[model samples]
Target: MKLFDFNKYFPDEKACRKAFKEMRDREGVVCQHCGSHDVVWLESKQQYQCKHCRHRTTLRSGTVMHGSKLPFMYWFIAMHLLTATKKSISAAELQRQLGHKRYQRLVTKQEHP
Candidate 1:
């Protein structure tokens, strides 16, 4: 998608989170601990609770953005930049484009080199 189109679809962090949640819901949320399909979404907590194991799964769990504290918009924009271009993007360049101050936030040590 073009930059304009991406901006149109994801205007803010809330939109990105909503889109991510929808995608996750479509893929189905299974309990990682008990292997159960019976999961409930706790909107207030922004997590999924397994009916059998009573385990709580974060929305970012089992996804690429797992364990990340950055805003959802950051991930969406980074993904858009990576796929919307033909050439490969470096970690530093991606950080620059995202206007993020920290280089480590965008890539791991193994990925940076």
Candidate 2:
């Protein structure tokens, strides 16, 4: 089961942003137009606007749940618990934790990458 404590997953925005940044930086973002790694972060917008192409890319772009219904915090909690537990949690477990019956249907009905 998720058994996630939201406070544990997203205790603060800074922590969440730091974790997200680390993951995002693991494979540094490259400009789609020029293949340049140089970029700048816009705090107000929370997106990276490539210094090369000036393209605006969202932190959530191209992620596994790009268009999924799962909240970012929930996803983060799920991932953390799954990794920490080192055991696969079933949909029913996640469904219970999420408190959304529709999630079970979505998890079952949709395909995951």
Candidate 3:
């Protein structure tokens, strides 16, 4: 998606989280610990609790952005940039576009994960 469309769709962290939850629900949330399909949404905790195992799964648990310190908006923008063009974007260029002083950490987390 284009930057404008991405921004329009995912305007903030809350929006991103809601969208992620909806997508996960649509696909069915399986418990990583017990491999059970029976899960409940814990709205207060913003996590999915496995009915069989009581294991909790966060929104980013299995996503590329899992464990990343950056905000969802940053990840969203990075995804847009990465897919927007035919040629791949350098981490440095991405950092510049992101206007973040420290790009190494973000790039490393995304690359390794």
lDDT of each: 0.87, 0.66, 0.82
All-Cα superposition RMSD per candidate? 3.6, 4.4, 2.7
For residues 16-103, what per-residue lDDT tens digits would candidate 2 score against the true structure? 6667767887878766567778988788998888887899777766566545655566666656666656678776676676575665
> Lowest summed lDDT over 10 consecutive residues: which window, candidate 2?
104-113
lDDT of 3 by residue, 27-74 (tens): 898898989999999999989999998999987777776777777777
TM-score of each: 0.87, 0.70, 0.82
Clashing pairs in 1: none
Ranking the candidates on lDDT from highest down gives 1, 3, 2
The alpha-carbon lDDT assigned to residue 95 of candidate 2 equals: 64
